[model samples]
Target: MPLKLYKRGKVWWISGTVHGQAVRESTRTHDKEVAEAIRVKKEAGLVSDHVFGPKATRTFAQAVESYLKAGGDARFIGGLDDGLLCHFYDTPLKDIQQNDLDDAARKLYPTAQPETRNRQCYTPFVAVWNHAVKNGWADVRQWSRPKKPKGTNVVRITKRRAGTFPVEYEHAARFIAAMSPGPAMLMTTLFYTGMRPIELFALEAGEVNVTGRWISLYKTKTGEPRGIPMHEFLVPIFTSLLKRPGLDKEPRLFRTPRGEPYEQIATDEEGRGGGGLKSAINGARRRSGIKDIAPYTGRHSCSTGLVVAGVHPHIKDQILGHAADDMSRHYTHVPQAPLIEAINKLPVPDAWHALPWLEDPLAWSGRLAEGTGRRTDLEKRREA
Candidate 1:
């Protein structure tokens, strides 16, 4: 018999026979709308394969549980889970084919200005299907994704390393100044040091050697602890934050308004989880009237400033934590004095004023919006 939905108390349940064996389960929902969706998914999953016969059928949720449990990097695993499960909840592992996935991609963030479908959508959906097939929990014909159409841009954000561009120093100074204390400090820190936003997020009070005037990152994206000499400009910021009452030597160096640690690159289930720090930058950008400024804009600018200030290439690597401590190669260790001196030489725009959220962001926003904003290839876009 085909699957049938029957009420159990106030909720609903499904029962059916697959390959001559009776299977039954609760929809666990009181609402008609939710129950109907669950009913469809259960029915699809339980139907004995007319072709393959009694092969086991796995629900999308079951496959996802397996994937999350077999963890590697938490961010990648969590990202895939969180991004995919909402779209495919209670879906039958076998029902979705490649064409369906392609259709689903079209609907996500369709109205986004750049038209990038959520690229993260790819992992959970694909990974779950593969895991199910590998484990004998599901058997379905392999499905291949269709070719991406022209002009549909999707950026899959993993842990960030490099940045796309530098915000002009004049624009940066004005933008940072208009932000609140927490974000203004963050923005300045990013610009002066080529630290990845995640690196900053993972920083702690104890890691900062106040007496030695260096910061040690015991946790980093590359699974290595790195030490960076603190810039004189950053000293006051760290000092002020560390002095917050009841904050211990080991507390997170940077925090949000609630005193929770700021977002880090990626820790094993700690910090802001990823988006909080970026959100702060975007929020500050709106208030500062700066267009196209982001958290990463500072890192790019900082590196550029070092290059412009004639810092040696090898020394720059150490300061930015990009140097590899490889076994076979001899690497020159950069000392504190020159690195600090080089950072002090890094240029700041003449327009820097006090960072107190004093400027009207709308004024700067308006100026940019009035055709002063960076334009794409207008002629090429018109042709497209």
Candidate 2:
């Protein structure tokens, strides 16, 4: 039977069989002429699919749906799809080409930089197209991406910078002292281990081996397990934090003042994750009079400190979890002694020694107690 349209209340509904398949859907209009047009288009699409197979009718929207359903990362893809769907809703996947992508990029982000166009538009489009190719809905074709003008440097000036910055120990110490205990400890760990913010946020209590003085990171930005040696300064801090009451039941090693785990990690265009310590760090920045200190500053400081201390580049790479060029990284029995020695060489300035937490690692415990309505041994001692 051919497709037929009938009025269901004020709206026209489509119901019929086309090419051995049943179709029943709303034309979603009160105008009979508009409904008839939609019904005709739908019938023609069904006939084309039956004659040429489903690939001839597959749309970019359909490819995106399949890609996401197959567990593709939707962090940026979902947002990119909003504009892309408007342009390619009914357009078949086979019809999209490199020129169409270039046009779409220009239309979507007229003033955006080449890097921004590449990340925000071309990246997601190519990803969806590649997924479609894998599913045999579209042919494989290399899409040209927008590139920055050659021989010209583009400096984007924003209030908050995204990547790492140089931070000295004295400045970092002052910043850490200005923060509340939880964030102070968290920042201190970041400075010592140079771990990514996302990796630290996802750290489990079980992953920290204070006895062995090593932090085992099972998931990293590089998708490989990393072992970071605990700095001597951090050994006492983690030892104290891990020994706190009820920590045995808590999976996350770090928490906010309210004793809840950090929020989910979010990645920016650069693919770096900072998780959730924004408010605390911002408050500390105001108090410390350090306007440039961000969560990633510590990681940069650690690397610089290691370099200034004259540690070898290879050992520094090992400590910082940078991809190594040598075969030593592939061996399971690689020695941690060199990495440990390299990390310890990071100098602790006098400013760090003056911080109160160094004397009593649990000093932050008082603040946690205030939030949780529980008193720590230090608070009880003070009362006594």
Candidate 3:
């Protein structure tokens, strides 16, 4: 039987059988003409699916829905779907070719850097397409991604580097000293542990073991659980912060002055995920006169420091949670001595000792702590 349109209250609905499959759904419109059009399209699609198989009828939008239902990370995929949907919404999954993807990338991000285009466009597209492939909705195919120009090692000195800027320990100490206790401790932890900002924001008080001198991260960007050895310099800082009166019952280790968890994660329209510390970090950078520094600077600085200090590549990779071995990841009893030794090699500048938070972290607890007294000499001079 052909699908027939009927009125259910004020809304139009369709019910009947097409291609021997039962179909009953709301057209979700009050207009009879629109409802009739929907019913016809539905009947046609059913007939095509029955004749050509599901792959021929399935759309990219449908595959995206299935991918999301299967627990795909929606941060980037959700935010960036408008352009993708505009290009491929009604297009059959089987009909989407490599050239179509390439055209989509160019049309979506005409002026974006190659890296940005790859990250925002190609990565998410491949992820959804691969998910469809796994479910037998599409054939397996590799989509080409934009690549950076090959390095020739000809000393090309650019004012600004392409990636995360690595701040020196001296500048880092100055920057941390300029902020209040809450943000200062957060930045310090990032530098020492080399953990991603998202991971630090999600850190629970229970995961931090001061006595063991190791912080356990159950969730990471890579979806692997691993441990980070706390630097000796961080020992007193964490010890002080953890011993605060009500922290024993608190779920999150890091919190704002108002005693709320840091906003953890925020997604921009471009589908980038940033930590909640943007304002605090910007304020600190301005005060310290370090225009180039960002929250990710601490992570980059940690990696640079490890390399400069002659830490082994394997040990550095493990500490930075980058492509670690299966044994190191699975074996809970793996020794922490190597990680600890590598982390401790990161330099601690003498200028950090002068920061009041280094001695008494709780002193800068309130909103008032961000006053003139906490400002660096450069900040003070600007005010004067």
Candidate 4:
């Protein structure tokens, strides 16, 4: 009915089936009392989900599967899960070792960018495994994570182009000014409001209150909708952009040039889907002759800028939909206004200025300008 007891070689064993599957196993105990206790714990786990419901007993896989399925066939399981699944799923959890993790890390090291692979692949798997351990699906001691190599050496650093800010917000006014009318306005909003691009992309026309000087962002990374006070610098610009015809009726405030509503900007089943806004900053960098600055750099520029501007880190994290200050380095809202202010406060290109250029702009520019002839040529052509 529950568990049957047996004795083999002077050791007592308690065995039973779990979830209709035979799960007979040695209790590995010399004492019958110990064997009985083990049997009770295992049997309790088996029926807990049925009697107490899902909150009482779901496996790691079950929970992850549920989370993935809830987003209407769209989900953001960490990239680590994909990497771990690719390399480790074939083996039992107990077999995973430092060597196994190292091999997996090396496999990813050669091909994938550290940040991308770490976030998308490594992080997810660790999270999934930890989730499993938490739910008693796997032993915590058996779980291992790739020992991420320290320092920036392993990373593929894309140098920014000359005359561009090494950091996105270093030349905030100019970056926004250089953007085409549509993207420029959006950039201005992104910089000031520090809203994640997705959160902004997911905005409704009525979400912004021009008079109230605030915007409510739904579907934020935090899984909660937060109303952020619109910076005074952003209100007029967003108001003007929102006033543009044909944009007001869209379900989402942001759209592609072709007028499609913004969707998740990730590669899906059919390959990387439409709405290039996810990589909009890269596109901007290409346009602005900046190199290697990602959409995330905008976010980094925002937080770092706020830090410089003396905005409280907690407040900055709250603004960026980031749960913690340290994790903000991973992904957070980019504050355009403060970042720009920080950039501008850096001594201007001319040496006569009192403030030292936050960095040597010329040196930063020179580093970025390397091997960017096509970019230079394009800029020249545009000026002509």
Winner by lDDT: 3
| CA lDDT, every model vs. true structure | 0.59, 0.73, 0.75, 0.51
Instruction: Please write out the lDDT profile of model 4 over residues 1-384, one tens digit for every residue.
Output: 577788989887766666674667788889988988888877786677557554435543454554354431233342334644445544544455557655766675567655545555555556555555544555665444435478866774575432223254545554443333344445455556666655666777677776766565556544445656576555545555565457645556554444456565532212133245435445566656655443344555566667776776666766666643354433323333443333233222221222121123221112112124333422443356
Q: How far off is residue 297 in model 2, in Å? A: 1.6
Q: Kindly list the per-residue Cα lDDT of model 2 for residues 1-384, writing each as its tens digit.
A: 999999999999999999799999998899999999999988997898889976788998788788777655455454434576666766798787778889988988899988788877888788778778878888878788888676547565655553336677887887777776777788888888888777787788778877666777765654456678788889878887776667667677777766777765744423254465777776676666777767777778888899998999877877778854346445313337777788888778787766555666654633532122353432444466
Clashing pairs in 1: 198-265
**Which of 2 and 4 is ahead in TM-score?**
2
lDDT rank order? 3, 2, 1, 4
lDDT of 3: 0.75
Report the C-alpha lDDT of model 1 over 260-311, residue by residue, as the tens digit: 5675444221113444665555555565566566676777787787888788
Misplaced by over 4 Å in model 4 are: 1-48, 51-57, 72-82, 85-117, 126-170, 244-249, 266-274, 278-287, 324-384
Q: Is candidate 3 or candidate 4 better by TM-score?
A: 3
- Residue 123 C-alpha lDDT in model 4: 57
The 10-residue segment of model 1 with minimum total lDDT is 362-371
TM-score ranking from best to worst?
3, 2, 4, 1
